[model samples]
Target: MTAFMEPFRIKSVEPIAFPTAAERRAALEAAGYNLFKIDADQITIDLLTDSGTGAMSAAQWSALLSGDESYAGARSFRRFESVVRDLTGFAEVLPVHQGRAAERLVLSALLKPGQASVSNTHFDTTRAHVELAGGKAVDLPAPDGGNIDLVRLRASFATEDVACVVLTVTNNGLGGKPVLMENIRATRAICDEFGVPLTLDAARFAENAYLITELEPEFTGHSPRKVAELMFRSADIIWASLKKDGIANIGGLVALNDPDLAARCRLELIAYEGFPTYGGLAGRDLDALAQGLLEVTEPSYLRYRAESARWFGEALRAVGMPVVEPVGLHAVYIDAGELLPGRNLPANALLAELYLEGGIRASELGTLAFGRVDPAGGPDIPSARELVRFCLPRRVYTRSHLEYVVEAAAAVVKRAEAIPGYRIVHQDPVMRHFTARLAPML
Candidate 1:
């Protein structure tokens, strides 16, 4: 393999903080041990999320100046729409502030009370939106990787009123694993058999396509853009958080073929978000997103993106940390269960330790993020996997920064047994992990 190098040069730089361990400890305590609550300035490396945290390119910055600020029928929106239509082959496109907003609009329109929206695995926000719309969220993740359990999926359609089947490419909820193209085709066939609309939660679509080219021999010569187009074509509806693959700071979209469903979503958009064209964002954001969509499909950038995460994952594994196999494109997930065996809330414990070790903040995708509290006063049910995700932002950070992270993680691993478990003291009814307060268990 060729040596890994960043595809783009650093045209600008942002200085990062190096808070003392004592200061980080204080910050962690003050924030109730939740990484999301910590301030950005207090963090040296913020791996809390990749959503909308990436740096934009020089071309994207230039596009921002060309934005038309019209309230309706904006030229910027038209350009953005055209780019999306060309890429995804969807006729009706509606812009939104972010991915979750798109989810709210689409799911609210399509889902009836007690209806189900099935997926390989629903990310936290997507699941929340489904339930908020008075629909049940059912996850049917394959035992391996990020594909739906085809046998179980077929069975689900036979028994439940499935509103839609959503396939999250490079499934975020399952350690950012790539979904196989063959799996997608088989899923499409099953959805067709059941007359269910197949939706692609394609936030990381480009990364998924790129990985497909690498992993699937039949798709060896396909460009990332072509692979992405094929993947999009398989879905009847698509929603994306441009924050990920769009390479933009803020934007999302819903694209579909159904006119009636689009109309329903448009009504919701006008009432809640801005006009259908602009949604809740300024015309400048639309323009920037248009350019970002074009740039993101470049093979060079995708290759670098995939390899960087893989490199980091391999490095972490070398240091006695068990990382999720087949390291994903956007993040490297550490198996917190293996790292801190028998410790309650092991992923949460590792999250705190990483912060104190190097002022590095990361998200816990294990029990805290996905576990469910027993309503009948029994023990909490843990997530299928106890993992901590180190989500790398696009066009930000370098190999040197990653090396520093590896070193910091190694320090924590050396004394992993010393880490303590935690108990949640306060949490919201839904998506509790975002704001949950926790205390270390003695």
Candidate 2:
């Protein structure tokens, strides 16, 4: 393979502050050993998440100046809507402040008490919104749900009282794996059979499309944009996090062919967010998002976006770090269970040590994020996977940053056998990993 180069140059630079281990240790202790609680300034290489932490392109910045803020009739809104319509082919477009807000609006409009919703796997916010709307959210991952037969599973749901169905492209909480177009078409067919609407949490649509283009050999001739159009064909509605593959810092949108549902969400937007045009954001944000939708689908941009992630994941694996196979687009999931099977430690040991060793902050993407516990109140349910996620923000880090993380993993691996686990002393009932307090266990 030819040596990879970033598609763009760093026209500007922001100096990052590097904190000493002592500072990081105190910060971790004060923050209850939760990486989420660590302040931005304390983190040396912030891999905690890829959301809204990316660097924007010069074009995006230029679009910001072109923003025309006029309450309801903004030129920025027109451009944003036009871009979304062209990509999604959705007749109705309603802009929201972020992805979760789009999910909330859709769920609020479509779901009701005692209804059922299904996904391959629902992320925290998506599931919360479903339950908040009085629906029971169910996950039926192809293997995890006790059967590899998705047809049977779909049949089961169709026979029951199903309200809505959503498929998260590149399942976020589960190592950012992209869902195949075959699976998407199958899900859409099932939703159609039951007269249910199928929508997508398409936060990483462009990256997902790139994977489809690269890995699915039959699609070899298709560009990423064409692949996206193919994928969008199966959905009734599509909602996306502009923070992800949209190539922007912050924003999201809900677009669909159904005018009535779009009108209803617009009403919800007026009540909860702002006018349908702004959606609780400045017009400049819309301009950036519009430009992002266009840029993200460019073949060059998508190629670099994908190549960078594979490089990061491969670097870690090269040092014997057991990263998730076929590394996904946005992050690499270190298989902590495989790395330290003899140590009897949770993924946190790897997480904390990564910080203590190199000030590189990752996340516990497995049992911790999902709030799993053993049957008899022991350590988190020792499933087949225990992942420590290192997210790569788009265009934010250089190749050297990934090298630094690999070195940290190398140091952590050399001492993996002797490292002790940690016990969670305090946790919230929901999404506990974010605020949970931990103490060392030797």
* RMSD for each of the candidates: 0.9, 2.5
Candidate 1 TM-score over all chains jointly: 0.99
- Model 1 ranges with Cα > 4 A deviation: none
* lDDT for each residue of candidate 1 in 1-442, tens digit (9 for 90 to 100): 6798998888888899999989999999999999899999999998888899999999999999999999999999999999999999999999999999999988998899999999999899999999999999999999876899999999997788999999999899878988989999999999898888999999999999998898899899899999999999999999999998888889999999999999999999999998999999999999999999999889989888888999999999988889998888899999999999999899999999999999998899898888888989898899988999999999898989999999989999999988999998999999999999998998
lDDT of each: 0.92, 0.82
Give the least accurate 10-residue stretch of model 2, judged by summed lDDT: 144-153
- Show model 2 residue runs off by greater than 4 Å: 143-149, 158-160, 342-345, 372-384
Q: Which ten residues in a row have the lowest lDDT in candidate 1?
A: 368-377
Model 2 — TM-score against the truth? Answer: 0.94
Provide TM-scores for the models.
0.99, 0.94
